[model samples]
Target: MINAESSAERTVAGPLRAAWGSRAEASALADVLLPPSTALPGFADPERWPPNALTRLASVLDLARSERGTPWPQPTASQYARFFRDGDGDRTDYETPVFDLDHRLTRAVLAALVSRDDDLLDEVADGVLLLCERSTWCWPAHEEHHRLRGAVVPDPDLPYLDLGAGVVAAQLAWLDHVLGDRLDVRWPGLRARVRREVRVRVLDPFTSRHDWHWLGLDGDVHNWCPWICGNVLVAALRLVDDPADRARIVADTVRAIDRYLAALPPDGSVDEGFEYWWNGACRALEALDLLEHATGGRLTAADVPVVRETVRFPRLMHLGGPWYVNLADARALPSGGQPWHVPQEWARRVGDRDVALHAAAQRSTAIPDTAELGRALRDLATPLPDHPAEPLVGSVWLPGTQVGLARATAGSTAGPTLVIKGGHNDENHNHNDVGSVIVAIDGVPVLVDAGRPTYTKQTFSADRYDIWTMQSSWHNVPEVRGTPQGTGRDHRARDVTVEDTADRFQVRLDLAPAYRVPALRSWWRTATLHRDRQRVTIEDSWDFADHGDSRSTLHYLLAGDVVRDGPGRLVVHPVSGARATLVAWNPSLASAALTVRELDDPLLRTVWGEKLTRLELRLPDPARGSLMIMVEVCA
Candidate 1:
């Protein structure tokens, strides 16, 4: 994709500026750029701002000027070595501090722009150099993978670049744009080094590849495509002073963004769940916002219909509580609900006032990590509009993906809400469970998805299913014999049907193929939510032929505490105090017992903050038969 360009390229792209030159482009982007005398959000005094987002971030650099004058301890490679050896790349102590390097850099940039504090900028100079001088801004685990798993086994000895390369390059670019002059006069060598490093490391390598797994080279490139590319573009437009180089970067962006848009599901769904929906879409939006701002909307991708439709994904996927139909590594609830920046940005673009209010109300929740300074800059410049709440009612079924979301009502607090998933196990960050179901009474989630557990070496390896959370045995699905659902594209639901009406919603899925068990002849499940009765029914029909002797156990994963009155009946109490009675019965099965399983892990502790529980209903295997489970919300 990066070769010699012709005269046509020069004439057409015309300096990568869809409009060109900083003055006019900045003029066109008057609404978005930081206004004169504009103070950054939470920058006034910075003493009483929200402690977590900025104030606490400022604490890392001893910016709070609170008590101790100590700065954040710098990170080392040894800090990440053990985590890589343990196969947990993301959890190392190096993660947060390394991330804070950017956090501090962003703060410094904000200080330069809003407060014009030379004293604050002086304090942050060492931090930027600390990051820029590192061999790679990426984690050691990524470096480990690069060392071990290159296509030729360590043959490509080039610098290992992952998501961090783009992150650092982009941040540095913005840092330069906002205060390059100050840096030039005070620290010329450091300012020049930043540009030189971005070009030598990120730009040169990025434009060279068209299909690097992170680039939308093959199948659906996950968040990394836009997350990395978008930031790189921001870096290029901000730092690369040469018009030809900038034009080349823009050409690469056109190719990259086109692929990114192409890979998005037409229904605007992310199989990785809404947590990823926020990460992936929000990062992509960052790129889109930059493009519109830089090119004056001349080189915009928003006209792509799927691009516009993706705005609804966060709202559409938000089940009343922290609950989401989340598949993959995503929890049923998120660390923080979808960031307000997402909905706020999309609301104005999509002209949905309901979403605008949703974002405005949600903005104060948590600030984003990547483009925090950029988001803060925009918030101070063009804040979210005040809009009235609009009802969010509807059943959305994406036929292509076999995911169904049925809201109780747009705003109802007392009704049965059902979310069912029947997709293949090959999805990104997938769990082996295909025919999984989650039911909630009002906003209280009764049955749940055992989300993801603490990731280890086995988390991404061939032994992923060995972990309980990644298997069907721990999900709201049936385990045939001892065989839970298998992973990969082949083991998936078949002949799925979704029927939604004003009164009731039904989704039927065949789970026979999902199980690799030889004894499993056939399995079908029909999950119906009777809104009128506020009841949810999960009907399963199993045919085992002679293999009926194989023990069959089904599970109902619940978020809250569980109480069992009998083998056939159990009561689920979501933390919100809402309760639902689950009754399982079959004509052939004479005796059944409900057993519980629990897990304690660090990640689980943070996500759920309690012991995770799953009720396993053990039953006698009939020659062939059906089982019906009814969940009735107590009046």
Candidate 2:
């Protein structure tokens, strides 16, 4: 635990005095504030609130409080005090040793207030307000004074203020005093400083430009960065007196929302996993909520079905629990990262129980009554009265030659369809995995995607390419000239065809158009799954043409423990100890070898276990090549 009283004393008073310049500006800005008469488009409809959902949520909160023997359902501010004090408090670093655990507790406490738990609400609100008053307003720089200093002196263009600390401060203020009256009293100077920083540093610079530009020149257009930044601007607009400035912020936010919404694939697949989804989606939803609340429902209605469908997309494609594969920088397995339910509360408010169910399922491990919620979700997910025949396609083609695809078949045992990856290495947060496929059989992962490791300096540098998850050597891909297939801007996959019959279903993917080398021309891959009641045969084929002397090697890197193996056959085991065999056809001309290597890197080894097995098949020489591998499973 942390010493809350002591920590608060050090941060609050001195910073207030230093922010006198900002306080003066804040007073000036407040004088010009004007509320918007018109609501922005794409906000949720006020008429569609879900029936009994709030009551159910209230019941859950009541149960939690009863079980925990606390007035509130969650931990106290004192219990969360240490999270704000653990690290060196560097802003740029990914590892924040100290976090305000009370933030989530406060959110839960506020959410629980829907049940009329006024006593708990008052207690939690008082603690949160006190904590906010004592602790520094923004992080990376503890106080508004430090933030203002950085904004004015060192960096005139403070880009991270929108996504990082500024948004957090705004959210905290919203929780502390819903009407913004109490915040004007106790933290008058601090609030003033924040307003000044926003107006001079952020709003002025952003309003001048209209094209798609992010804060840092990192070229990383992440989901939450713009979304949260927009929401924070909206919050700032609420307090500012200048009508022009307020209108500018609101217009900028709406435009940014349009751009952000456009990035979401038509099928509702977001490249960043559930974590990013929560951050980005919730911010967008909050903006929508705020627009409705402020303007009395004048905003245009969002496509509720589409938004709800997007929320359900992840659940339909989930491997297990919180473990979603690395579609685009997504971890294949679940870590102890925060769950998606934090934002799902907003989803429930919009009358999307299906979306709520998805969130509930992902966060079930943390919430005690999640099993019941999961069951309820399953009932809701049952086959519709008039379901469509075509298997849902959750795939998107990005500008940088990135083709990401995910599909789910009709029948339970028919299994989820092929989830394919073929693209460039230069894309945002990308790995070297070109032409990697993670297949699920009977809703269970037969071919696995090893999730991401912890991000540290060591992990990013020397150990980056070494991990099986990040390496091309660990995927089910073809090896070009005894080396992993190098990625370029032109790399992509298309001309896909699927044929389904009574006994067999085959999917053929054309990759010849993706590569540039003349020798690798006409390169195509095919996977045929033949079902015979309880057993299935998965046959793969690679066809290539026009190489006189060049040799090509096809390989499958098994990323799991080796349970057992015969003299010739390599048997790789999964977490559930399910047996899967790796069989190569042309082993005589091309040698096949299986090697079990331990994950030596500290960051990767911590998340995934120490050991993994790689199965490699090396081809000697071929003029025009063809290679094949078959995986058969039987109970």
Candidate 3:
């Protein structure tokens, strides 16, 4: 837990101001030089303070300082060091090369100051300043070395003047030392130029692209790009004093917010995944706060409910732990990374303690001292009894609509009763395992859907896509004879059938036919909490007019240390440790393997890789038949 005294001391209402005040005059000057459109709207209003935001902010600041100071077991220096290393040509292996360590340290120092730990703040500030000076010398030369080697060194020519890095450096310098008379005399001008350059090079280009071609645009399916870009603009606007440009910036930002918010389904389902939820959601909220502060509540009437609902999306979708693995490109689960602060900050702002608690609960490792704050937020944010259930399904269902089914049984210790998905391949960060079901009996996963593999080149290439795990060959349906079960451009599950009885529950889902194949249909019948055991049976019926003599097979490949009883039956031992069971089958007598070659589709190869291995269950008979798998849970 964070020290109370430290948090109390660092109680500055607006931390950004403290960090950037030294350049106020120069910013004022730049504002005069720039056109009116460059300035953000409402730059002159008194700064708006977060109502309760400072409390958690102070706690986070104190905890970060404590963690940095204590010799708590650190990851191997190599692990920390690898982030600074050069990327191999593989797109999957690429890491953001630039490390804003000085910025990070500065933020830590500022956080410490917020916590009222002046001594610690002073110490951190000194280290950060020194690192900043040294990094300026090291990064440029290092990057040049790589550029000479024909590597895809980012912004190679502008080595010494990377915009994002410069912004962090400038903010740190201004916070630690006053400009003009206080610091080196040239510091003020240098700071202004850095701010201007960042705006011109990075901010301007990125924003202009949004206006001009919209080709390089990040899809609006989720909120990350616009929010990040807006924040950058806000920073640039803060540095300039020109009222006209400030207004333009404000208007543009508001427009972006409106467009991005439109993408959210009214029910607040963010299919893009949680990583982006935090990234985009936090930035948007911050932008709104900043806008309102500058405009003296001119934007006060903005859609507060939408903002609230947007924030709530992550909470509803949170499966367990700190991870939310939804849609494509999501890692198997959420990681306790930097974004955890978002919920905490929001909880404080809205005076809702439960949201804060939710954030704290997610940090499984090195629980922060701010758990109390989280608990408070959770309590306040708890929904009222009459609150309606937010719709979870979208309206994009095709010939076969996507369906999710689950049943929670009484006296069932099994984790999830049953969780099933019948939809097109997840497009964002998808795997080839569509029409897959992950079942957990009494909190234990029995029939499982194998999660993603690596994100590097090996998995992104064509070689992996040909594999059953990355293709339709290993799934629970029929595969076209010669052609692969290509990704569906318009894939969805429809014709849903669900029934629940006192003793059992059943759900059946139909998926769209595979690509280039005659209209094919398949469905799965799952009987949950049966008399003694659970059963999942799948049936596939296909009529291929163009393709003759095509055979279908069911595929189920087992992984880990499972004892195979026979080709038809396998019993897993209780002693062996496993988290879930992976079940996949093709009823069309298709060839199946644990791993196969990659395919040619760029998107498929990019996500699932060229070579892949997954548990496959292939049906031998395709005519008038059904495949059934029964899992008996050992309580």
Candidate with the larger TM-score of 2 and 3: 2
Residue-wise lDDT of candidate 3 within 1-635, one digit each (tens)? 22121333224212222322222223332333233232233211112223344443455555566656543221232332333352421322222222434334444544543444555555454544444333232222223334455433334233332334434433433342222122233233444554454455444544344432111123323454344444444554555454655455444445445445555555444544455565565556656654554544444413454566555545544433322334444442433444444555565566555555555455333223323221222222222122222222111112122434443433323334444445565444445544555444333334433344444444444455644345655543444444445664455445666665655555565543444545344433343435334444444444333334555544442323344444444453321233444233333443334443344545434433343334444444343345555555433
What is the C-alpha local distance difference test score of each model? Answer: 0.65, 0.45, 0.42
Candidate 3 steric clashes: 79
Q: What lDDT tens digits, residue by residue, belong to model 1 across residues 42-139?
A: 23344344334443234333442321224755676566565554445445476767786667667566655545556666645666787667766665
Better of 1 and 2 by TM-score: 1
Off by over 4 Å in 1: 1-69, 87-90, 144-157, 365-371, 385-390, 518-521, 577-596
Model 2 steric clash pairs: 32-241, 32-242, 33-240, 33-241, 33-242, 83-98, 83-99, 332-451
My TM-score estimates for the predictions, one after another, are: 0.85, 0.65, 0.61
Which scores greater on TM-score, model 1 or model 3? Answer: 1
- The true-versus-predicted C-alpha distance at residue 184 of model 2, in Å, is 5.7
Clashing pairs in 1: 392-410
| Backbone clashes under 3 angstroms, per model | 1, 8, 79
